[model samples]
Target: MLRRFPTPLLVALCALTLTLVGTAPVSAAPTSAAPSNQARQLNQTILYYDSSRAAEYSSAVSSAVDVWNASVGNVRLEPAASGQHAEIRIITDDGWPRAHLGPVRPGGQVTVWMGRQGTAEGYDAVRIAAHELGHSLGLPDTKSGPCSSLMSGSTGGVNCTNAAPNASERSRVEANYGRGPAGESAADGRLLVDRR
Candidate 1:
């Protein structure tokens, strides 16, 4: 029971339908598919460190910060602005290098003791600082790991002066900070005294 329209009329109707479809507004896709610009900005985790109390080890601490900043993308380490609170504090002492274990949040505090004992024993100062900082960033000692492992700490020996973290160590750090500020948890708080 189909009625045939004139060829010219049918062609015009088809063209009008195409135009209407082409001009129709599209519904927005789910935002979960891509994060908004502001959301991405909020997800960036930057931890400031205060090393003013580190005394003679300040240079080593700076070098350690540089190593970590270069190694990870999810987190960044920056020197605290004057008068600003810092999450990581570096100090020096005569004991073996150690740190308070933490996945320290922006306002949380953790200590990195740049012990002269390790340096006095001939361990590299920069390596010691970086290793202690690693503890603050939630890493534990892999005492049996080789010199290539930055978390290996003093067990790598005084001859193991590698200041940069190895691939595994870097990946661990990235994972730790990838969750951003909201994901931060209570600091481990246990003091890791690296006497060995």
Candidate 2:
């Protein structure tokens, strides 16, 4: 038989769990020398955008991609050409912006929702796009981060229009996708629950 935790205890536990889930590193270093050129080529992860519903926010998507592309070199996100199979799909919806924890590897599917809710509240569209994409890239929300931290999500407040990933954020993504021993797994995706 088990007893339930008190309300306060439960809340605290939930907070801690959320923190750990969002902040813990999800990468493992390779056990041996790096793989051959062919293997390195195979490690590239490409994310395709649905682009239909997100048409209105194309600039935001492009800006977000530019931020990530400029920040890291291992992963490349491209617009899904017609009839192309997209590993990750992004669309616009009515709720708060969010993304599926993810497919993490190729041939898997993940969805990113670009909700108007955040924009309506004054959050920068590019930042929201990048923040949600960060989830797909295996980053969790650092709700306490200031405007400069891209993963800070909504906690940076509406004025945080900065869409660039900070140094640490950039390093983490590079570590996850950088060319190295062939077997390092990309971290799992984590949803950012709006605590505000």
Candidate 3:
């Protein structure tokens, strides 16, 4: 024969059991930590460019986009979809290449002028495209910097042709985009002309 506990005792035991279980520690699953690490990459800011008006410089623009995409993790550059308005516009002109400096936000507008003069003067087309795009990414001209620095522009000379951004330039672009869209400011809209 089994003995039955009093109703009051049974209730007390039930409450105690629930309290103990409720207070038990939970160890996080390994996967739970993965999202934090992946979040930044998953949230990478994307800026689109319209090269339709760039004319003969389209391939050069594409190559410059490739260089930037390979160098940074916080933002990505992609061709604008048909009928979609792009944040960056590439156009060809007879003058020197220039870009409206911007850490351009999504839906914002900035122009990159791919001037024929630069190519005519023997500067690498890819280098001119990359340098102008760098201005769109918020990089200023480091006119005195060596050829290894993509922002050095025409000062790197016609033979320079180094279309890749150096470590510091990459880091600055990464930091600019990492701040997300809300961090955008009017001051980022300066026009950078790549003369000389």
**Clashes in candidate 3: how many?**
0
Ranking by TM-score: 3, 1, 2
Best by TM-score: 3
lDDT of 1 by residue, 1-196 (tens): 9999999999999999999988886655555456765675577688999998999999999999999988877778989988999999999988889899987878899999998899888899999999999999888889888899999988887799898988988877777777745346667889999887
Tens digit of lDDT per residue, candidate 3, span 1-196?
9999999999999999999988886665577888887997777889999999999999999999999999998889999999998999999999999899887878889999999989998899999999999988888899787899899888887799899999999998887787745345542788787878
lDDT of 2 by residue, 2-67 (tens): 998899999999999999988876564453446665575576666676666685777898889888
Error of 3 at 57 (Å): 0.8
Clashes of 2: 1
Please list the Cα RMSD from the true structure of every candidate, rounded to 1 decimal place. 8.0, 19.4, 10.9
Candidate 3 regions off by >4 Å?
1-33, 180-183
**Stretch of 10 with least lDDT, candidate 2:** 179-188
Candidates in order have lDDT scores of 0.87, 0.76, 0.88
Colliding pairs, model 2 = 101-189
TM-scores for every candidate against the unseen true structure: 0.77, 0.71, 0.80
